[model samples]
Target: MNDTTATLDAPTADDALTRPFPGASPYDTYVHASLLNSLQQPLTEAPDEMGFLVTTQVMELWFTLIVHEWRTARVAFAKDDLDAALDALTRSRRALTALSGAWAPIAALTPARFNGFRAAFGRASGFQSAMYRHMEFLLGDKNAALLHGHSGDRAVHEALGETYREPSLYDEVLAFLHRQGRPVPAHVLDRDVTLPYRADPGVVETWRQIYTGPQHHPHLTLGELLTDIAELVTRWRSEHVMVVRRAMGAKPGSAGSSGLAWLQRRAARPVFPELWEVRGAC
Candidate 1:
């Protein structure tokens, strides 16, 4: 090759990717990695505490992304934008998978090792995570008591209150289907959005029709996407149970929850219940 060609092909010191920024790196500025690194202040010198703190913080970040995607999907459904809705749901499923995998760091901590750092944090439980609560609310698991718990934090209460009052992602999906001529029950359509959603027989029948109809139906694709998200969510909960079982076992949760039992109950509750119910008929 010619020298000119060789020079052009070779990476230069002045290349934008290799050049240093005038202040903080562009990536650091955009992502705020410095700010994030500063947040993990483990309270004890216990070796496991840092890992536990980092893992929990990482999970919180994944929760934020999942909530953002769910909200996007909800809006897309409201606008009758199936493709956009599916894209967002697909993103969230991947996030949930990663969220589940995040348990790896502390998954094997024995009870003794866990207790070494557990007492240091004192009542700061994963159950108190507002972001995770937002995910639950988005999935139609509205609990008045949970929302009320955040009442002392005006900003958090107001934000969660908006999600509580608005139709959940599932609610929007059913409305979108109704707009497409599906027979979603009028009672379900008109139900108070603030209340916890109950699985309606009519909704199950609607899903059954979709499952039994054309295999390539767009609505069927939507159903599968939702099912994937639901299963991943359940898997994440089950992994949480596993981690807690290994780390602390049957003990009370950091924030006074029933610990393993509470997590098991949550894992047992199916997401998008009608979709799961339709499987039997199909």
Candidate 2:
């Protein structure tokens, strides 16, 4: 037989590769991809709406992954497991980068294009994203009013309340540093966990010691990794502000926020404030 004929006549291995599953494919079952794909039911036929909806949904999933990783890191820090905590923080940093990248699809929407479907999703603003709030809470930006906003949803409220009650990831980090013989102040260490973490002079001193120590110290490496994560988060927030400006300049947000102004103010708040402060001190 000719080589071409033989190749065509033979049952190729590709057949098995393409074989269908009995019901849902293994990939679908494991990833719940069917359910995820089913969620993008845009409320309007405007072309830009799907991109906007899908981008927001994608960010929500990223937020979920980031929160999971941060929680893992927080637990690791609590156990004084530096390696595990660093691994988790590294994963979360990657997720934040991806979250920031997810804005590309909707980032350049013209105000007219956005206005087409913006009114349809009335009062359904990004401000109401519970998972994003969880991320903020984890970053030590606790807000009682924001947490209370989810009170109508008992399951969400209860879950978020626990995060509200618990020490943030940064808090655990300070406690871990204190255990490692750094002079994290007792008052700062024992401060109320539910309140927003302000930049404490003592915490700045603690980080300053780490930053100014031997150049190759593990603690300094940890500080830099955390700084990377903080910068990525800030970049994401700044990109969010730019996207809002492009889509709808200065318009009030659907959830009653002052839109661009409110987001600009929020983005101004630094994550890991002492870490940033220590750089200048060093």
Candidate 3:
């Protein structure tokens, strides 16, 4: 093996604690881990509450990172900077995988353990997570009802409402493909930006062209990257459903929906529907 590979494979001990630094280590100043640690104020004495709170906060941070990456990809796509877009997408994919894994801390909580702290928070649930909604909006999961859920908080509602009105990252992608000589329909490209993206047959055909084209083409690489992203998004939803099922069974959600059942329906739908549909034809 090469020296670089061997070095990467080697293990190092006491690398963090043994290191010396000035006031507030560089990581602390940048990441504000100390400030973050102070935010986990569990409202109840339940042992599981801390894990649940921390897990949710961690997911929020991942969601924020994923949203930032997606916005970068969207701008790169708009400028026809395919390599930059691809780099951003790859970063978002890794962030999405980490986000999915963030469920572990609270993944297997019993209904009893969850109940111990569920009522203490009243109507607060993951459903009210603004950063999570930002990630969804970028994926074209725009929902007016979900945006309205934050009306009590003017700043949050305005930010979410703006996203709800904007064309999603997928919308920008199709526009990019059209400029690259794909046959994406003008109607699909011009559809109202406020609505949730639905599967379009013409869009499916456009993806089919990419799939049927010469192997190793850049557009095909783009398609595969998008597929990876789509799969990751579905995985997150599935994991959420699993976590909710284990913690609440068929009971109503803290947000008023039929907890596991509601999430099950949401998880059943694909994020990039046309991307998945095109696979069958190819």
Find the candidate with the highest lDDT and give its number: 2
Q: Which lDDT values do the candidates have, in the order given?
A: 0.93, 0.94, 0.91
For model 3, residues 64-116, the per-residue Cα lDDT tens digits are 99999999999999999999999999999999999989999999999899889
TM-scores, all candidates, are 0.94, 0.96, 0.90
Best by TM-score: 2
Clashing pairs in 1: none
**Model 1, 1-282: lDDT tens per residue?**
999999889987669787877999988999999999999898888999999999999999999999999999999999999999999999998998899899999999999899889999888888788999999999999999999989999999999999999999999999999999999999999999988888899999999999999999999999999999989998888888898898888998888889899999989998999998888977
Best-to-worst order by TM-score is 2, 1, 3
Residue 161 of model 1, lDDT score: 91
Candidate 2 vs 3: which has more TM-score = 2
Error of 1 at 62 (Å): 0.6
Q: Once model 2 is optimally superposed onto the true structure by TM-score, how far is the C-alpha of residue 125 displaced, in angstroms?
A: 0.7
Give lDDT: candidate 3, residue 239: 96
Model 2: residues with Cα > 4 Å off, grouped in runs: 1-11
What shift in Å separates residue 6 of candidate 2 from its native position after superposition?
8.2
Which model is ahead, 1 or 2, in terms of TM-score? 2
